[model samples]
Target: MTAVSIEKKVNGTPVASPELGEGRDHPDEEQHTPQPTPAAPSRREEKRLDKSTDRADARLDKAQEREEARRDADHKRETKEKERQAKADRKAQQRADKDKARAKRRKERRTAWTSLQTRLTHHMPMWGLPVVLVSLAVGATGQAGAASAAGMGWASAGVPVLTEGMTLTLAGLTGQAIEQRRPYAWLMRATWITAAGAATINALGHYIEGKAGDPQEALYRAAMYGVASMLGLVLWWVVMRSKRAAISGKTADEVARWKRLGRRHPLLMRRARRVADNTGKSMADAYATVWERANGARPGEPSIREIRASRRAAYRRRLAQSWDGRRGLRKQSERAAAVVPVPQADTVGTPESAGSAGVRTPVQAPALPVALLVPGGQGGWVEHPVPVLPMATPKRVRTGSDQSATARFPQGKDAVSKRVRKSVHDDRLNTVRALVESEAARGCDLRKHPSNRAVARAAGCRPGTARELLATVLAERGITR
Candidate 1:
């Protein structure tokens, strides 16, 4: 509320005093006034201020760290998600591949089954004696009400099993006979005889017991027993397999010697027998001639040493020829040519007429043309036009390695086709696998005792080849030897 007048010289000039005109202070006067100096803070106050400043900086640093941590966690989560997706993709791919393979295999099996059924029908006769006996046996078992129930526990179950088993066995026998070009007719006949004998035995028992019911019931019991007797034939077959009859009625020692020789050089023994039959000479003499030819011994007769040398040479030759594909082809060609027979010249007259010295005129029929010998379209000899055979086209045979590739991929252009083919892979070495597997399925252990020898015999291959194939199969199956 009080006013004081003050004067100051500014730049060597006198300053002016202003009167209060309004409720505002003079801007020039305020700019010229000197303000009071601010006091410095005490040590405690400064410390408190410094602490507050430090806390603010720490809070900002914590916020930045939290942001960085959050980013790192996000990055880890994203990386893990990507890895999981990759793993799942791989598993899905593997599953898809397995499914495709199974589908392809099923298709191939279906086709093979169809082909097998067709082959089976031709090889077996449904109306044969074997079938009749089997039917009769089944009918008897079904009709033998009290007989089956009073027997052992197995009897009731065995009736159906035996029926099915006998049927399967017959089918197998038919296949074996046809595929192996062997005769099983005698075995089938033996089965029938056993069945008949069993029926007779059963009938006699019923008659003796005075339990003979209706004729039909008696026959049923007999038929059931007959089927059971048929099993005896199977046992007999097994026994016969182990016991070999004397070869051509030779003595035991001679047969033993032949077997020993056959084991080493089957070809040599076969040639000796063939030569003996053709020349009407003794086997010993035929063998000696073969030895002489093989050894290049004397022009007249060879010594003991030369004969031994010839035997060794013949063995080596046989082994070498066994591996020679060219030699096998040549032999096949020769056999084919021999099968096409050529007609012999017609005899001018009978031997009796020529020997009698008769001057009678020989009545000769009109000569037939040589072309008449050729087969016609109807598979019969034609006297008019000669039938001409079409030229055979050569087929490409895949070798071992090529066969593996072809079996896997087949010949295809589409990707799906190629994939399907690759899914069901195979190997050329599996050519004998079916034969080996069949024997194994029949409870044969070709890997023990006889080892490769048994497998080779069953598969129709050399022992060495069988061993190699067995190794490959075991390797594929992940089995250790």
Candidate 2:
């Protein structure tokens, strides 16, 4: 059995210890023991616990408020920074757009300035207005001075308006007449007369005013006043002329050409006028028709056929007169002839044979002389002749056809052989043949071929030569028109 012992009690309750045998069924202890009830907590301790809980809650709320404020400040700062950046971008974009527009306008202005017509006529009014105003002011002053000198004291101011006004009114009428395409010669003459009279009056007035000071100064003042009074008239006349030209659809060059033509040929202009009235045609058409009839083909111009004929005649004359007014064929006969194979049917006839057969043949021209005209001892011209050596003739090849002919030429360093001549002829013929083929391909009738001028241009020869070549080619191809 364990021993039991009694222990000291707290709060008036006794405790039993097992080692002291106090917890055993103690026959020595009281059988009926009273248990002690638990006591309630004290008021002071409860109050202390409530105070500590309130302090913790208050600290948590303050920390939450501080966190919320810090977050709001950060959000505001971020928003402001974004807004600033957006504003900067917007401003930069605006500047870029403005700069682009400005550059476009500048480029447009530069392009507009590149044309000569624009340069001459654009902004003419802007420049002319200032000149007109200045001229009016100076003319008025000169007229007033002149009128006062002429014993019209207060009436002098009205005199300038009458004189200058007449000129201006006449000029306006002239402009109106020009716009209507009516005859404005009388208006122009009247305007000029009025302007001259006004200028004279202004000059006289200025001279009278300045004569009291110095005679030379008075003359200078008179000239200055006169010119100033006429300055506006001159500018107005120029404007009127420009407007007239524009309305008439005549360019400056066309006006200059007409003026030159009129100056050179007054009778022609009168004849053109009569033709215009009789034929009911425009002056230009009448002039052109009359000119073509008086001259030939184009106005004041010769036909291509005539030009080529003249050139060929001149060339032949020069060739004939090359050696002291002779045929100049002796030099050509001295050189050896090269061998050139030519078909019998294609053989060109001699001049005498051509006259009988009505076939034209090309005559061989002589060479130029190897002589230089040097200054003579007595100041007269003397010929210094140079010696020329003969060349070896090429061997001729005989064809099977008895009618076939071979032209021979010399083979040397300086000789222009018959082979070269034939080749040049062949080139010209080939050019004409190609032109014919092209025309035929384009559906043109071979009977009616192109003009001689076109063939001449294509073959790089004169019209006469081209005409002959074309005829030869046509005859070979059995085409006749």
Candidate 3:
């Protein structure tokens, strides 16, 4: 044991000392040291850890669900897009098909039109050559026969050649003139004259032969000879006419129309030609001008559409005007009530008393009961005292003093027949007027001098009636003719 001094200080000043002992004699003393222990987790921390785990799991599940929903949406979107694309493809294919069909149809129509035009315009060589050959042979034979009968013998054959050659040359000249669009009237006349002379010669020869034999046989032979001699000329003339029409740029329809117009309106054609000569205009233009001047309308005026529209308007107006009356009549007939008139005896004045005293005594007859016919439950009409509605008055009324009720109402089948006749007359008059207007619009020179025959033929009316209607229409339109 050892002692040691211990001191205590307050502030910096030493105050007291104590003895301390050191023990070194114990050899087996144990040394002990303190160590810290870890503290356990709290319930809130464990709860928070569990909540974080749950939140992580929930977030993962939500992410998986979102991905699945997105995938589904994408799949649905792709399907919809594919369907739309397929629909578009189908539409495109259908459109292509329709276009192909339309194109094919158009091609077919064009092909048919081309074929038709070719058939119409290319017939000269097919029939013309055969006809020409036959006609030439016949003409030559006829001419030779005529010459032989005239006692020329072999010289007659040479004469036939000369005549046929001259005719052919003239015919060729006429064709050339037609092709050149030149005036071939003189050439045509020459050809006709030559052909006629040849025909006459052939007929004369036949006549001479027949005079030596049977007269009937001579007539038949002469006729045959004349017909054979003119066959070639006729064929050539037709070809040349067709060629002329082609050169004039006139279609068959136009030629036919012009021919029809000429036949129907010779006066118009003459007037048009005169106008053409005076105005120095083309015949067509001059014709139009003349037609306009005469008809008071341009060519093709009052078109079918216009006429139809006018007719429809007239019909509509008439219909509107008659609708109410017709409807009322129909309704009244459907619910008709029969009316029985009550007869009352009339008061009579004695003639002698009136002459003697200038006064008349009136006598009244017995009144009769009025009955109305009504439908019974058994579908039969029964008379009753029930009041019935009176018949409706006519739409038109006459206020003249001379017109009686009977006259105003116009009863009986005769009245109906008269009405029907008047209606028919009006319809016929309208028809005539339409025909006249249509003719005028179609370029007929109706104002100056209308063709009554043409009008009568078109209207199916008497010529006198047509003339009267024409005059009436012309007068109504302030025209002189």
Candidate 4:
């Protein structure tokens, strides 16, 4: 542990704890004396008995001396602890009492800042207040976030602590700008970019609404949220990008990563990009944490896609049964409809029905011969029949054993669904059976592989289910032979 300096006001001057050693006054002495013996009657005693008694007394004295030493040490420790606690309490009280005054002073300074800021509003026409607030908020927020991260664990804290130092430096520079004639534009931009980026990410989450369903709706919502959230971010970034491009003589969007390394300069776009990237990484971690919570997994655990796939396959099988039977019913309907005779045009009507010359009246039109009817009809009459295109009728087909369809095809090609796609992506199982067969041939033990990685390679099978299926297949084929 690092030596922590605790300031002490021993007299009228402040002294670090190391100087005082937080000294504890020694404990009061405790005496343990041997039991006093009465003068032997007439001073006469056996030599052996007297010697034994003397030895026993010596042992007692040794034990008492050791006990006294231990007691003294414990007492000193306790007293020091008490004094340390007392001093800490006094300091805490002082800080609490002084907090109001500190806050008052801070507020006065902030108000003076406001007045100065108002006077420079037009003078600082190029930038805006949101940028300044966002910068301060980001700097403060980064400081706070880094502090929080530092407390999580050593493995997690190292990089974050480093980043915290970097952010504090940036914030210090930015804070100094509140008094600078011309503030470092990059530092100012860094804060604004950070805030805007945060807003964008938050909006992105709201937009996605989870992958529960309605991809289009989710995408639309995400886009709308992103656009709305980035309105301010976009404006700020554009302004910053423009200024950066002007200074570096590079394009607005481009910034060399090397320039961001240990950056002490203020107007560097690379610095903002670095901080924004760090924020993104943290955001991604938070998102991953949330994902794990929803899925009942720890961080970096594989998604239980096989279990989901099994459930989906079951559901699709059920739907197939419900829907496959409907095809026959549809076929029957089509056959029955094919036999119904189409009505002729003479029995229908003509547009000339309203004429009284050689053109027949509406009452006489129906009596005209079918051939003489001009094979035509009025607007409301039924139109001529159109030839129906032939449909490939569905035959009764079995979904077959293996419950997974890839088994039936000799080439071992993947079974494509006319319905939904599988949960695992295609790259994992580029050649579904080749993966399974080759692994089986090698006598490879999947237990040796990472569960999720192995399962993904097994044609998106659940790790457990895939193991079972492989055993079954091997047994059926006598691979053990």
Q: For residue 267, what is the lDDT in candidate 4?
A: 34
- Candidate 4: residue 50 Cα off by (Å): 99
Per-residue lDDT for 1-481 in model 3, tens only?
6555566654445534422222223435443332333455688988999999999999999999999999999999999999999999999999999999999999999999888766433434455667777877888898898888788977987977888899988877777787776778899999999989888888888898889779999999899878987887787778777887888898999878888988988888988887666535577976775564454335776423354468579766654433321234455444332323345445487334445566565644322144446789879999764333334443455456424333212332234334544544565577567766777788877675457875565444579978887787777778765
Q: After superposition, how far is residue 206 of candidate 1 from its true place, in Å?
A: 6.6
Could you say which candidate leads in lDDT? 2
| Candidates sorted on lDDT, descending | 2, 3, 1, 4
Question: Candidate 2 — what's its lDDT?
Answer: 0.72
**Which stretches in model 2 have alpha-carbon errors above 4 Å?**
1-127, 152-162, 277-280, 303-481
* Cα TM-score per model: 0.25, 0.39, 0.34, 0.20
TM for candidate 4 is: 0.20
Error of 4 at 313 (Å): 21
Tens digits of per-residue lDDT, candidate 1, 64-103, equal 9999999999999999998999899999999998998898
Candidate 3 residue-wise lDDT at 434:
79
Q: Give the winner by TM-score: 1 or 2.
A: 2
Query: What is the C-alpha lDDT profile of model 2 across 1-481, one tens digit per residue?
Result: 7544558766566666444545557657655553665775588977988989899999999999999999999999999999999999999999999999999999888887666435334323557878987998899888988998899989988988998899877887787788788989899999999889999999988888888899999999899989998998899888887887898898999988888998998888888887677646688977875565343344545543455478578766554443332333555443324212222245567333544656665644333244557899878989764332333243355445533333222122112233344655786698688889889889987777687887876655578898899999888889766
Off by over 4 Å in 1: 1-67, 83-178, 183-189, 199-481
> Could you give candidate 4's per-residue lDDT for residues 1-481 as a string of tens digits?
7756688554345544533344334334343333434544333456677888999999999999999999999999999999999999999989987997899999999999888876544223236756544543543343343334335344433432444345445544554554343447688767655545544443445444444678778667656544543454445445444544455555534454424422643333333334335434333343343343234333354334544567578766544433321234455455534433334446445454545577653432111112211244554544333322333345435454424433212221223331112322232243334555666678876334223445433333356655554444445556531
Q: Which of the two candidates, 1 or 4, achieves a greater lDDT against the reference?
A: 1
Arrange candidates, best TM-score first.
Answer: 2, 3, 1, 4
Q: Global lDDT of each model?
A: 0.53, 0.72, 0.69, 0.48
lDDT of 3 at 197: 88
Q: Ten residues in a row with the worst lDDT in model 1? A: 419-428
